[model samples]
Target chain A: MSFDIALWLVQDGVTNGAIYALLALAMLLVFAVTRVIFVPQGEFISYAALSLALLQAGRLPGVVYVLVGGGLVAAALDIALALREKAPARLPRIVALYVLVPCVMAALAWWAAPRSVGLPLQVLIVLGLVVPLGPILYRVAYQPLASASVLVLFIISMAAHYALTGLGLVFFGGEGLRSEAFSDARFKLAVLDITAQSLWVVGASFVLMFALRLFFEKTFYGKALRATAVNRIGARLVGIPAELSGSLSFLLAAFIGAVSGILISPITTIYYDTGFLIGLKGFVGAIVGGMGSYPLAVAGSIGIGLLEAFSSFWASAFKETIVFTIIIPVLLWRSLRSRHIEDEEE
Target chain B: MKHRLFTALALAGSMAAGSAYAEITIGVSLGSTGPGASLGIHYKNAYQLMPKTLGGEPVKYIIIDDASDPTNAAKNARKLVSEDKVDALMGSNGVPSAIQMAQVAAEAKTPMMVLTPAILSPAVAHWSFIVPQTTELMMGAIAEQMKAKGIKTVGYIGFSDTWGDLVLKATEFHAQAAGYKVVTNERYARADTSVTGQVLKIIAANPDAVIVGGSGTGGALPHVALVEKGYKKPIYHNHGTVNAEFIKVGGKAVEGAVAVTGPLIVPEELAANFPTKAMSLDFTRRYEASFGAGSRNGFAGYAYDGYLLLNAAVPEALKKAKPGTPEFREALRGALENVKNLVGTHGVYNMSAANHNGLDERARVPVQVQNGTWKLMK
Candidate 1:
């Protein structure tokens, strides 16, 4: 390939890599705090994109229904717990999470969905509809089995992926939807024309990454979440509510997923099940980063993106095979380099 | 035990008599709830618009969701044949599932109509009738269009499936015969989100035109990527993308794309003397009347043609045998094979013992996506 084409490929890879990096960061955060693989993280991305598509098409998105249903179920579970513990003091919070938030969102969606809404408002509505789904999903599916083994959680995560995929089909139908680009402006950068959407994706990803770093390092809730991730039992003993940390982490993952979905939707036609593969790519990035280090995950994601882009240029047919095969060598090197530790009994 | 055996025999006799006298049933197995749902839903809507009866007898349709799975299609076909005792069968939004349904129909001695275009051998053709134009038939139109445009070199990007393989092979054969060299061939999964790398490679090859061989909305991915990358070459798509869903998903990116499609895609706009024009307009009217304005799709037209083919043959078959028997089904299959000069929505089908599709250049047309509408090429 020519130098200019090579430079373009790198740019394309980095743009995709930025989305993967966000997904990877979300995966790490969810896994660290909740010990769940967050398989349905990609579903959130699809839902967000589809919701936006529906809004643009002048149709009310089904996300409002899902949010209300999920919130109701989660709230019911919380209510049952609160009544069981005789902790009526938590009833208002439970109601707020379950009844009030979903109702308000649903009401806002019902009102705003019919009128002519701008892109910015539509995007925010999509994000609002999708972000709460993460914690609600955790509460409905994972929180009950919070103390279960990682293997069990993994299986449940897979089940959740299937459920969410089916729900996506119900919500968005089978056809893929593509939204209008955030910006159509193309800047001529010497030999390549860089799209404004690419710049938006890269810019948003970096901003979100830095913002996440600041949140984790500076905020009190972030420190509590960090404590919970460091040692769940110790965090509980030290009065850090592990459950709150779990929900907070999922909320962060949801935000990342929703943002990634909105950013990438314009670049590609996203189907109901598109998020699963994209999320898997992010998971691969997380695995490459050893699931702990943020910088390494970001680097690994860029490597993966570049490899996929270059491999497609070389052998478009086997590009997926090549991208997936990268996991093997990285896994081997990590295993060879790392020391084995015995399992700890909680 | 003897009394129970007698009761069972009596029950079996009654059931046999009951089915033999019931309304003629056409079992349809389609990918109504999966990846194929987008096209399948249109097929379903078209079938719904079909007449309720043929030859003064009630017709029943047993629609089964194949979920875009070949196994499910086969199983559904079997169930429709054995349990439902359907006189005929129709399916399936894809080639693989259609092939499966054809296998079952052959074994059961029932006539089966496939929605998607497929290569039908004499053996499969005996029991199966394809509604859509075959790849070779459509490729001739695409090649003719390219030749007229003075296209010398073409790049190919298609789905990594049987449909893609068929389109690519046909394009290679026809485009080369027309003196156009296929400079590059790239394959991607139907569910792929991006085709940038494939587009880049094709652009690097610097072909005069690019042919994307994918169906439904998936076909739009490569072309969109090409447009986004500022590739100014003409884009061509196969007959598989002759649907509204593709145009809706593709948006402005595919505005100037030329595609091979069946004549029924723009039936009303054809010349007044066109053979299938009136029939196509009729189907379009009924379809649009029910589905709202501009809801008529070429995929649905294929299903409507299937119904017309069956409508013309069922009366002839009814003369030889009753509607709910194996002999009736066999006669129906034979009558369908003999159907000639019958105008349907898509084309004037001329089914013969040798040719199941029964379409010539009359069925194939070149259409350009002009101003977000399918404009028939002169």
Candidate 2:
């Protein structure tokens, strides 16, 4: 309680919290658009990281090479996914998801072999691709499957996430993969004794989140997305192209997921199963913010990050058990209070 | 008729050419994935790269995927032993993993080279002989050394899994015996992001020092966090804690952290006259050439020695056995006592049935990270 572990907490937490927040946003966005809570967002994150790592380590070009690779891979995955949903409307959303996620990953693994793009940047590139990749799959592959069933979409995402984990085991050979962003670039801030990498991660994460919020709030498409989320049928009647809005939501979520992976790469080693942990916590953040509140989700993530920091600072041993237990009461209190307010209004 | 016969003869010649070289089949069950798989890779490379054809005899290895699960290890070991009918077994790396596999080996009466640190215990020789240093024994040395240094307190961290649990208990046991106060600083999943909070609590305790048992990018965050927070007490790290990759991730913050790694990274003066020293060096060189990397971790050292130990015993047992006699078990048991001063990447291993782990204080070269590299301790 006494120690100002906040400096350590903030530096470490923000970088990590940013990653989880973005990944969680992808999960929430997909749910908001298609009404499916995908479990496999982390799988895409793992693939992006591994592919980038292989690319950086070998004969592949610099960041540009990795970026082009990420783009081509995402686009091709999107196209291939688009083709697979021949009867996107006729077949269940689950069916379309099953067909597309594995195919994209298979392609990723093939490219990653015989090259390594150094681990950290690779994770960022992979995450970058994941954001774009989600939209591509939704727009192309499920063209006919629009607004079918949120439940089915959620199931599809879950399968994709699980599939991504298995693929990670196959490709990365089961060891922790990490990147060194600080040394990769170096500029000193006077008297701070920190590297360009740490500064970039911090600055970049805050900037990215701000940009995403702007994109969501300021743009016309952003309004359409909000309309679609709030009242899909009403928005459709008003000529909002709710279908397009849904796809855009998936895209926006993907961007957050990408940022999450990219920003956190320097702090933690990216593992195949890493997503499930981050994904679960991030979704919790989303929930704590009230399922529909964007600002709440962002705030919740930061709060969770702080709580984790404090827990670590105090209960260092068995803190996970304690924090998770505490979460139950926190969640219950929020739920009871929300219900009480609604009761009074009624 | 001549043309017909020549063509027929040519066809027969071609078929003969295809059949001339006999195919050799062997098993290669290991941790193909997971935290410790990296070590399995290096060890497998060394064993596989060994001149399989000594005096024109052929050898073949087919890796059975164990997945690091105990039951899976047993199944895969049995599968390799019976279905694949592998001539030899090498590459299982955990005590539980190896022992589970050993049940199958013992039942099959097949000789298997045990590689995992858990298998290096005294109890392991009952089923399979171990060539690596027992992790428990290594911790013993580490604790004794720490105690001798008048280190009154220690910060303890572990991965919180079965393997990590064992190490923590072992470390606590040994450290306590030497009269060192060990505080439980942190235990989190291998994928956890921030350990600063845990690191902060440890720092606040103002213990004489901290000891981190987990190694990897995930495990390293605590070490890196401590360094960033300016915690400068002697940081005693577990084996496998310091590697080129670890330094790359943690950066200069982990510089001067203490660890007891395998002897391979140590300056080559400890085993001046061991017979296996030259051969082990060649093996290490060949491994680096094959994998395009080098690790000073005990995983490589133990795995390589484990295989050589297995191979050394195999011939002696085979020589005493009746040709085609299913007496490979008895022969192997006898060969265990004779393993002596075999130089391995980590240390000189002189395994006896009573002491399957040949590593001693001399075998363990204590080192610390200096300027992003592992520098040997004086």
Candidate 3:
């Protein structure tokens, strides 16, 4: 390849790498806080992007119903638990967060769907429709199994991924959708031309990453989440609610996923099950980081993006295989280097 | 009690005899839920619009979702043949799944009409007749277009599956005959989000034109990537990429993109003298009317043509044996093989002992995306 072509490939790799980095961060956050792999993190990305596409088409997105239904189920579960515990004091807060908020968001979506409310408002509406699904899903699928082992939680996560993929097909139909780009500007740099959308993806990903760092360092809730990640029982004993931390982490993860979806949807067509592969790539990055270090995960994911770009150029048929095969050696190396710890659950 | 039992037995025996000649059952397995759902849904929709009877006998279609998996398609085919006792089988939008169903059909000694252009082994090809135009026939149209345009070298990008391999093989097969060189052979996964690397390589090769071998919405990715990178010579697509959904996803980027597809997509533009014009128009009208305008796809037309082939053969098969018997299936296979000058939505089919997919150049028409719609290129 010539230098110009190499430059173009790098731009493409970095742009995709930025999106994968955001996903890796979200996967890392969710896994750390809840000990769940968050296999459905990519579903949120597809749901958000597809919701935006639907809103742009002047149709009421079907995701609003999923949000409302998930909310109702979560509210019912929470109310039943509260009632069983004879803790009526917690009922009002549960009703507001799980019941009232989703209803309001659904109502907002229903009203804004047909108004042709430009791109900005439509994106905001999509975020509203898809973001709550994260915490609601946590309450319904994960909270009940909070004390379960990691393997069991991973199994639940896989099940949730399949369920959400099915639901994605139901909501978005079988067709893939690509939204309008956030900007139409194109820039020529050196020997390569780059679209403004790639800049937006990389820019937004960095902003979100920095914002997350600030949240973890400067906010009380973020610190509580950090504490929970470190030691769940100890944090709970010290009056930090594990359930609250779990839900909070999922909320942030969902926000990150939604942002990544909006950023990339314009550049590529996204289908219902598209997120699983994208999310799996991010999981590879997370594994390279040993599923813990944020900086390492981001770095590893970018490396993966570049690797994928180069490999696709060299051997397109074995692109996925090459990318996935790297994980085995990484796993072996990590396993050899890190000292094994006894099971925390035991 | 004994009198009542005797009366019930008599009624049951008469009911069985009456039901025997009442209906013919056809089992359909399609990937209506997974990766191929976009095309699979269209194939399923065509069944809803198909005639309720075949050869003056009422017919029942048992449609099953294979979720785009080969194993599921095989299981569905077996179940349909054994449990549903379907006289014949039809299915599946993906080539892999269709091939699996073909194996099951061959094993079960049932006649199958596959919707996709699957290259079956000679052993199984006798039982399963391909409904759509074969890859060789369709890609030949593209080669003809390239030769007419005086194109020298071509860049190739497609999915890394059986479909991709088929398209590449066909392109290479025609390349030698057309006096053009294929410069690059690149492939991507169907679910892949980007093709920048592959597109860059194609650009680096600097071929005169690019031919994308992908289908469904996945086909739009490489075309759009090529356009965005300023590769403006020409981009040609095979029959698989001709769909409303592909256009919807590619939007303005796919404008001026050309594809060779079944004449069903441009029925209104077909000449009155065309053998399949009337049928194509009728099928397209019914399909678009039911699914809404702009949903006329080649996959559905394949299903309709499969029905037409079966419709023409069912009467001949019925003369030999009853509907549900194995003898009827064997006869139906023979009858399908002997179908001559059969007019359907896509083209005139003439099946023979050696050829299963009987479509030729008459079935394909070159179409270009103009002003957000497919316009026939005369």
Candidate 4:
């Protein structure tokens, strides 16, 4: 039974689900701090993946370049955003993140083109930059628009997503690039082939995501961010600096997204629109995990990944069909039950 | 928006007012928007190429945009055949859209041509001919070559989509039939970035070789990932996999990987010194000049040929037409069937009352991507 393809499918599903889960958990971070859906989240994933490919190809020293590129993009967004306010001291940080656009892209272009960094490196570059985007956008864009309706924020999220997707296509071209993260490595069994690269990426993502969860929960910055999520005004009164926490959350999410992009690029070719599906699936994972719950989002991400893998393994043909069909039924059931409970309470 | 529109209207105004024709105006549908529409250039050029080469008189040509949707492709095909009163039709750059267009063309009996690599389940047109060297045909050709080389054991990886399914099924069937050992078959989502696990599994299986069957760069993804992880094996690539972009992304990884393509865009020197001597070369040069390099994938080759094929039909129809008669349009339809040995970018194209697809494996030329450029198969 353990040797059956079904068992293999289960294992594969779990592995893939973990990857998706981490991405969703990152998305959930933004959702918890700000109410918008952040549709642009997927582009960040693609961007991060592209960035990683660029850096890895150029043989830039380990995780440092990823960190440096991400930090520089975030810092640039902060400075430009700070300048947008009539009174810099009075303005909120969330409204200022859009300033990172030209900077983020310029940094990426510098690494990807001209430099001729390989695919793995491009993936890293995209991965690194995307991690800071959601957070910085929140710091500069969201804080100023806090009094506005969620609809306005939703539009902002959509606009952000579109801007990135269009820009990516114009700059990167429409085709998916094959990453050189893995080129010449192979070991074979009866019907199973595994590469050292795939294992390393998967394993690294696992360790990194868990470590992220710990940082967001156990660390002081993590607690401050959580406090801001629960009672921003109160946290601000208590000197928690609510905007900074929001910034931290967005940055954390972007980092995870970047990591996810780099790890996944060798398997999924990174293209401009790579984010749409990943973002949606990541959002779905976050919702399934009850939203704003980091652990649950991670768990939910795993569920989505496994479900996708199983559907492909068993049904083969109706993999996507099964995902949407099952999701619809479950969503309908949960939302209906909650609505009935609310009506009774009323 | 205004800039884009002005460009369109300016081009249209220059080519405005078509020369009057009595033949039934057939509506052709393809990508009218986005990256897929890039092929429309070759489609337009094909109309211009036919007159001088085949001595075809002018016929009204109508092209429709499907907007990159299969459902939209169906609507476009229907509108062209039913509403526009086009005598014949052709559409789709690849599998998903082609499947939908094929259905619309069949019910309408529009004698449609699908210029894609997708295999239509049960031929779609009353006179539907899929363009030659279909993705399956081309892949099958490579598989046959592999069999001849005694490279039996194989691994397959691709994105989980329609085109991928075709490559997986066709390549597997042909490889197994040729006494090859099956080792690994895997698929990743379109959004997946890392496929090291799947590639590793294939590597673990230790197949004699790998057959990558996915459209665009997705096919070579495992190759790059595998090599980084230190896997070594001969890899066979399908048409869409062997492009400069994919090779560039894969870098030093693409060498030694074999692929299937057509010599659709031949140099002038390669063309036969016949009347339409440099027709194919002219098309290739013009297409490259207009579009960037790596724009001429396998699909573009057939699409260019498809237009020329129809344009040639126009002249034959004019010869058969009784001037100033309604019967002239009917006569044009009758003349289209007689087209044979009309050399296309692939090879001499032929169409009969019973058959539509014009070529087979003989026309497919397998090439290996060495370094960054495509190298013809040795």
Candidate 4 chain A weakest lDDT stretch, 10 residues: A337-346
Docking class of 2: acceptable
lDDT of 3 by residue, B305-344 (tens): 9999999999999999989989999999999999999998
Better of 1 and 2 by DockQ: 1
In angstroms, give how far residue A315 of model 3 lies from its true place.
1.0
Native-to-model Cα distance after best TM-score fit, residue B322 in candidate 3, in Å: 1.0
| TM-scores, chain A, per candidate | 0.98, 0.72, 0.98, 0.76
In model 2, the Cα lDDT at residue A266 comes to 62
RMSD (Cα, Å) of model 4: 7.1
Positional deviation of B249 in candidate 1, in angstroms? 3.5
Candidate 3 stretches greater than 4 Å from native: B1-22
Task: Report how far residue A346 has shifted in candidate 2, in Å.
Answer: 29
Off by over 4 Å in 1: A336-344, B1-20, B120-122
Ranking by lDDT: 3, 1, 4, 2
Worst 10 residues of 2 chain B by lDDT: B50-59
Compared with the true structure, all predictions reach lDDT values of 0.87, 0.63, 0.91, 0.63
Give the TM-score between model 3's chain B and the true chain B. Answer: 0.95
**Tens digit of lDDT per residue, candidate 4, span A1-346?**
1254444555566666766777777777666665556677676667666655545555332233333444455555555666775447733442333434435555565655557655555554565456555555564456666545657878887876766666665445456654555554755755445555557666876798778668767999877877776765677788986567766776776677667666666655777677777778877887787665777787777788778766654443456676656667667877776654321110
Separate DockQ for every predicted complex? 0.57, 0.45, 0.75, 0.27
On a 0 to 100 scale, what is the lDDT of residue A189 in model 2? 44
Model 1 pairs in collision: none
Q: Fnat of each prediction?
A: 0.56, 0.70, 0.66, 0.34
- Computed on C-alpha atoms, the DockQ of candidate 4 is 0.27
Steric clash count of candidate 4: 96
Query: Lowest summed-lDDT stretch of 10 residues in model 1 chain B?
Result: B15-24
